[model samples]
Target: MKTLQVDLGQRSYPIYIGSRLLEQADLLTRHIRSKQVLIVTNETVAPLYLQQVLDNLSDFVVETVILPDGEQYKTLDYLNRIFDTLLTHKFSRNASLIALGGGVIGDMGGFAAACYQRGIPFIQIPTTLLAQVDSSVGGKTGVNHPLGKNMIGAFYQPQCVIADMSVLSTLDDRQLSAGIAEVIKYGLIREPDFFAWLEDNLESLLDRDVEALAHAVERSCRNKAEVVAADEKEADVRATLNLGHTFGHAIETGMGYGSYLHGEAVAIGTCQAADLSRRKGWLTDADVERIIRLFKRARLPVEPPAALDANRFIELMAVDKKNVDGNIRLILLKSIGEATLPVGVEKALLVATLNGYGRKG
Candidate 1:
């Protein structure tokens, strides 16, 4: 097993990445500060791996909340359900919440732990690639609001993150591809060599090559950990991680959630960001096509939904968390391996990019 650390001083935690790491009791038990444990998972994930986690935690007092699976379910109402479970069980502040599914569960569970009795310990056992690489590592936990994705959330760190590659075998193809979108984001933002490696190895990753998937997960986490360490509160540099998320979140909320996978929307959003970069004379047409081709090769959607137009996109993005003084800040590419954000882009250009690029005719 390979362990990487997210250095947050007092809040520092280790991310354990390897195959079958979930079967190890000590790895998880050592992180739990209290004897009480609340395992928050979804219906889809519980059937596959819940028992394994429970077996490892047999010694602790445990309660499980199996949530309905999907992005649409990530609401304040559902978040309340988690609190209800905790309250019903009389789980104390010392109780630890274990997030045991994909991003949805991680976000909700982490948020629950953060708000429960003014914060309690939580561990992340992310089952999906998207969660393992992105959502699980950084302490950015929250549920989506009707107005925005992750609109209501907190920067609460996890006690530890356990990513077991063995569990990934059960994931469907579309779900696996969705996770790769986040993997691709790391390359687009800061790792030129990693991007090149992905261009060559994306096929192997799609085929579920163990080494490729492991490398992708570890590298993605390393990149994310470094960024989060630098700006835990997203005061600066860390916002770069949302390279395509602003446009992507608008897609999720506009489409009414769960209609399109988050990673699919991110792939489309990355294409749009690349297109906007081209319009700003930063990326050449070839660069834009290269970006699109990589996403296409990953079986991700390269075009935005036909139903959303420039006006609708503008209205949706208006609520973006990165906006400053009402100007929607965007993370645009200066090159294939570098991104710049908080850009005060022209409205007309944004409108044109939204309408002209990545729009399905």
Candidate 2:
């Protein structure tokens, strides 16, 4: 097993990444603060791995809440179910909640922990590649609103993150491709060499090569941990992590959620950002093409849905967290490996990219 730390001083926690980690009870039990435990998972994952997690906490007063699976279910309404379970059980602040599914479960579980009794301990046992590489490590937890994605959330760190690679064996091909989108994001935002490495090794990842998967997860987590430690609240450099999220969140909300998986929307949004960067003369035509080609090779969509016109896209984007005083700021690429922080672009330039970049000509 390989362990990485999110160095947040008092809030520091280790991220355990390896195969069959669920079989190791101590890795999870040691982080629990009390006898009361709540395992928040979804219907899809419960049948597959809930018992394995339950077996580990046999001695504790454990309760399980199996949420309906999908991005559409990630909302304040569904999040209240976790609270209902906790309140019904009379779980105390010391009680620890274990998030045992994909990003939806992780986000809701963490948000529940953050809000219950003001605060409580929680551990992340992320079962999906998207959660392991991005959502699980960052401590950014929340449910989506009708107006925006993740607009209501907090930066509550986890006790520890158990990224068991064995669980990924059950992940479908589409979900696997979705996870790779975030992996590719790290390279585009800052890791130039890693981007080049992905160009050569992406085939191995698609084949589910264990070594390649581990390397990608570890490197992606390391990049996340480093950035989070520096700007836990997204005061500066952290905002750069939302390279394509501004446009992507707009897609998610505009499409009424679950229509496009989070990673799929990100893949498309990143491509649009690359095109906008080209318009600003920051990246060449070749650079834009390279970005789009990678997403296509990963089996991800690089085009925005035709249903969302530029005006609708802009309206949705204006609800983003990164926007300041009604100005829709975006994280655009300065180069393949370097991303600019949230910056407000000229409305005309932004409109041009929105109308022209991904439209069928």
Q: List the global CA lDDT of all models.
A: 0.92, 0.93
lDDT of 1 by residue, 1-361 (tens): 8999999999999999898898799999998888899999999999999999999998899999999999999999999999999999999999999999999999999999999999999999999999999999889999988777898989999999999988889999999999999999999999999999999999899988877889999999999999989999999899999988888999999999999999999999999999999999999999998999999999999898888888899989988989977778899999999999568789988998998995545
TM-score of each: 0.99, 0.99
Q: Which candidate ranks first by lDDT, i.e. highest?
A: 2
lDDT by residue (1-361, candidate 2, tens digit) is 8999899999999999998999999999999989999999999999999999999999999999999999999999999999999999999999999999999999999999999999899999999899999998879999988877898888899999999988999999899999999999999999999998999999988888888898999999999899899999889999988988888988889988999999999999999999999999999999889889988999999999999999999999988888899999999999999999898999999999999988997
Clashes per candidate, residues 3 or more apart or on different chains: 0, 0
Window of ten residues with lowest summed lDDT in model 2: 144-153
Model 2 residue 347 CA deviation (Å) reads 1.1
Runs of candidate 1 with Cα error greater than 4 angstroms are none
* Steric clash count of candidate 2: 0
